[model samples]
Target: MSRKKEVAGSPQRAVRGPAFGYIRVSTQSQGQTGISLEAQRGAIETFSQAMGYDLIEVLDDVASGMGPESFCSRRGLRSALEAANSNNAVVIVLAWDRLTRYSKFENQLRKIAFDPNRVVCIEEVELRQNGSKAAIHKYNEVMGQRISSGTKAALDRLRSNGVVLGNPSMKTSVQPLGAQAYSRKSTDLVRQIADMLMESDDPFSVPSSTVVIKLKERGIRTMQSKEWTASRLREPLKKARRLIEEREAPEPPPTFGMF
Candidate 1:
């Protein structure tokens, strides 16, 4: 196999170093859709090739960009940062948000791991070291403030409009203002599961494995069209049991001695 050689007289070829690529998507759906992992990898590869950098490795994650905890918990990000720091290599990302949504976290990462001269984002941003530092700093400040205020405003609007924003099980949307949309099949499955749990001596304490076995016997598959694992059935079963208990709980008697 013939190894590709760098073309002569290319500016990028003249400026070369080891480059570590990092990519991320907030959800599985995002990983499957446009700007997917594959797309990000391609972009990174192209940039690395053009810059004549030895592409060390591409690290990735399917995680939210909400906060520092989210970024810290990502195994790939940790490994990538460690590798880049140890190798004294540049870290490349497709965009700024791919690195972090939080500006504070981004700044901290730059101070600790990312060298402004080495870290490169494919997107045309003012933060590039080659750009005017003073101008970029002012621009970044204004843009960061705007983005933060905008996000806060959006969240406030959602809260005011009664939209559930977090975990699916914990989410409850009001009608008229918001819709509590559940598929018919899912509703029926949950109800059946609830009934099965209610038959146990203590529904809340019932093992998820037992529920999974029952579900399997019934030939019922999850919304994802897969056999239920213990973890998969846990939350739905718990919610079902809660609903059943609420329905079965007795009402208090009306007081008749009021003067």
Candidate 2:
């Protein structure tokens, strides 16, 4: 299929209304496998053409499908949903699980139903504004649970076989110095700086010079064995503050059926 130029303004409409594609893959490796982003895009685009709808845009999210937060936190999915709501268009995916695999799928179903737009999962189900056929939605929910379970089992098998998952080691030459590279001494010093700043009335107003002095007094040197300059000290302190904030952030509200 020919790639059309993405327009800057409102999406061009068709006889059947605009169609927005939403695609996702859990990991970079999944993005390269058979059920890749490209495969999903092709399916959505082809389906849109066959159904007489103008394909407006394709949004992608590289995130796991295990939880509602995974879907909620995806910027791409948010944009797609907003566009769909604005245009009263249909959102297409390769399967229902691509949207979410939450144990209680009805919560997400209800959310999509709030708007007049439809959600079309090519392989498993189609949810319309009027609502999904109860039996069909239930079947899709069961299938999603099975898929999540199987994926977890496979990951467990890989772990048992000593195959490490997640991102590879950062190359120092290509990337900034990561926390892993810092010695315990430097890490503690950075944390001390972060804590002091956090305690201040205005964290941003806490000058970098104060951090430098603290590092010098603590006899801490960077991974490169250089004296702590304001610029050199910023990244570690930033990382430390981020870690603290993440630890202090409130947990997400529980999904439906948690009670």
Candidate 3:
């Protein structure tokens, strides 16, 4: 047989199967920072070609590493799961955490009802197979739960010490504003509004519409990559107290409210 024919005839040769790739960017900044959907697709395609697998599909979503508590909230992720389950193609991801942060993702996995044995997680290598899937998921669930609980406890302790939480650390990377930086801008605007409010004659006294208009004039914007409205303005304004005040202050008179 010819060398090509002989190589093709070898049963011991590696053969990649049909595969599906999934990518997610939690922040708009990630989308523009070049780890975008297209970039992910290209990487997955390269990986698939190198391994000789046929690239069948790509699934992605924009969601945070917070938790899968938002599993239902993400249409793209839901569709990705459905595609993976329905098709026998290998479901590939850049990382497991891209699926969700540890805590609630295991619960979501369990609820998904796919055959545990048929599942495989591949990073630089295949991490697990279907038979080990359930056990691995359980382990992840336990770890995530423990971490989440520990985080809550830590935050509570910090609160008791009067330390601020969720406020960004100065060491973190600064994100830009607008469609490319939704959460960052929204957070900044809320903080600014909060400062204005808590220092006002009455924090709750300002109309939401008025606050939004004021915010726009000052170049404030929403996290959803859009302008704020009266009702929408009310939400972030309400959240301002939570973000600005780590814990509730003792009730002073509703007026004279510099607690």
Candidate 4:
């Protein structure tokens, strides 16, 4: 709003040196039921001010986040990434879904040499990561965990509103398929890790190959979209063991000094 350089219709930005806003919405604009581009733009611009972003320009796309569409299909999002790379600026969004709800966007960002720190989400609770490869992977792990929670939360909300998920009255025609679809969710991955830790007497000395086999058996892949590796499992294994150790640690005796 700070006197942006406007064209006849659009604005010509690139002055303040670091920020691009990307917004995506479905076709339901003009006071529709769900969301409006105006609202998204306003929220982003306001957040930009507080975050000290120059807010070079705001590019928009009309699309639904629930689709399995690729990022290349989104011209506006692609353009925003290109522009961000050109200016070495940050790409800010109102929420993670405004960018994408899945981990696929990670490859797209890396392909264009975009820094992970530059991708900002106004409503994100996770901290941003640096441009290091390890940091990006760490960020992806955090996002992978957070992303899966939203779907279940939405379904719960629907149930609370008296909305039925599956047909309640219909009888099943076939037997239930057991573990037909493997879960790649972060929580599931953690549970697998915990199981491995419990089976090992020396949890700290447990090899990465053992954990990788467990993951493969469960059909879970790392955020990098491949079988788990030592480097990828390093942090999680240590963290999980530390957590277990903390949980099973005995409480210390009361101090000699009186309260």
Candidate 5:
């Protein structure tokens, strides 16, 4: 790792493949909470070798990831993007959060004409394979429905009227993508509730409100760790329906009829 390829004074170079490596540590010392700097490098190095990404340089950053972050704030990120632009290499991070805590990470990627598709998050890719990203993506879809309006509303209404909006039938199976800093509680609960409803003698008649009550009676909570509500159940409920359709799973044993 010490073999320097010298990307304008970058000290670390792992391989000579087409990919670039970037790692970050929010804590001042490597001993702080979460993955140490070396661990990230090791992962990125191994990934690059296996994937044939000639990782020339691995930029590092150590700073508090608070509030909105910009390329100007993190010199390492800025350098990585610049190098990516010049080398036409994709940037690699151990995880998306390590790249930047900011919600609008695309802003930085957009600046250097970097192909957003090329910015690979190793863990996220694995999660997609595991079907674990399903619930998180469902949450994001719900958020979009809440925030996007006007023309978006028009498009949605049109689609509801039987207008085609892309391929509505296309889908990828997603499982819960949870790691040390994440949790699969939300996904697991959603699937469980879905199974319960499906196993019911008459699932269509089982009011979601009543279901919420049953959940509270059982001391179950939402992904936010709050009491579940009928409205709160909407998105995940739809997701459950999709799973039932996609999986065509046999009716599981009665799991929630005891209530």
Candidate 6:
């Protein structure tokens, strides 16, 4: 009878509800600079506010991937996930990298679908342009390639210049760019080029000459239709904002070397 009662009772499980958000920054600098914990919270709050999600808890971890194990693998993160699973709470996050920077592990998380949607990685995946499904995928792929190649080239150039890169302790020495080094117009052009390049998935990957010709045939400009040239399309990115117009916020100034 006891055994039967045990079988009949089973384990009573209470339905869970969405209640927590999880955020993480890989390195101390990333936590402080590029992807600050505060920035993560702000972004999450903005997203939640717009989407109407009841965010009741936040789990923030400041851990770097020194090896294979991720910050998500920590006990605190594990406990948070368990609680969310039991409560069926949606775990809101700012970007997939914030939760798990490693692509492979992030993929694993995607595979293990949790009830109440375990995580929400905002700004991690680029949305396809409104159009045919096939076209959107193709466009995104191309853009991603261009951006990646451009970034790689920029990093390589920096390395060649012998500038110290990375955190202070583990940094390699290199020269630093000085103030008043670049002209305003030049800076603007650099910025435009960088924007175009960053938006592109591969710096080397671009529409073929024929495609460019066709676009020109259709009266479309190759970035600068006023004076179209292959060189124009391949220039480095830089910014040209007026010094006076630049925001003078003292609290959170953008610093270099975060990358």
The TM-score of predicted model 6 comes to: 0.38
Model 5 lDDT per residue over 1-259, tens place: 2223332443454544476778787767652532456566666665565554677888877865555654568778778878888887888787778777777767656766777887878777563432224323433444344456446878989988988886443443232222422446656877788787777876657788878887788887877788888898888777766766666657757885776
lDDT of 3 by residue, 141-201 (tens): 5546656877899989999999977647433554333344766676777778888777667
Q: Residue 12 in model 2: shift from native, Å?
A: 14
Which scores higher on TM-score, 3 or 4? 4
lDDT of 3: 0.61
Candidate 1 residue-wise lDDT, 165-241, digit = tens: 87665435344223324456677778889888878888888888888998899898887889999888877887798
Angstrom error of the Cα, residue 67, model 2: value is 1.4
Q: On residues 4-76, what C-alpha lDDT tens digit does candidate 4 reach at each position? A: 4232433344344578888787564532422345556666665555444677788877766554475767788
Off by over 4 Å in 6: 1-17, 32-35, 65-68, 71-76, 103-117, 124-259
- Per-prediction TM-score to the true structure, in the order listed: 0.41, 0.41, 0.39, 0.40, 0.42, 0.38
**Highest-scoring model, lDDT:** 1
lDDT of 2 at 222: 80
Which of the two, 2 or 6, has more lDDT? 2
Tell me the whole-model lDDT of each prediction, alpha carbons only.
Answer: 0.71, 0.68, 0.61, 0.66, 0.67, 0.50
Candidate 4's C-alpha lDDT?
Answer: 0.66
| Ordering by lDDT | 1, 2, 5, 4, 3, 6
- Candidate 1 TM-score versus the reference: 0.41
Give the clashing pairs for model 5: 16-54, 17-54, 18-54, 131-174, 131-175, 132-175, 132-176, 132-177
Judged by lDDT relative to the true structure, which candidate is superior, 2 or 4?
2
Q: List the residue pairs that clash in candidate 2.
A: none
Sequence-dependent TM-score of model 3: 0.39
Which ten contiguous residues of candidate 5 have the minimum total lDDT?
172-181
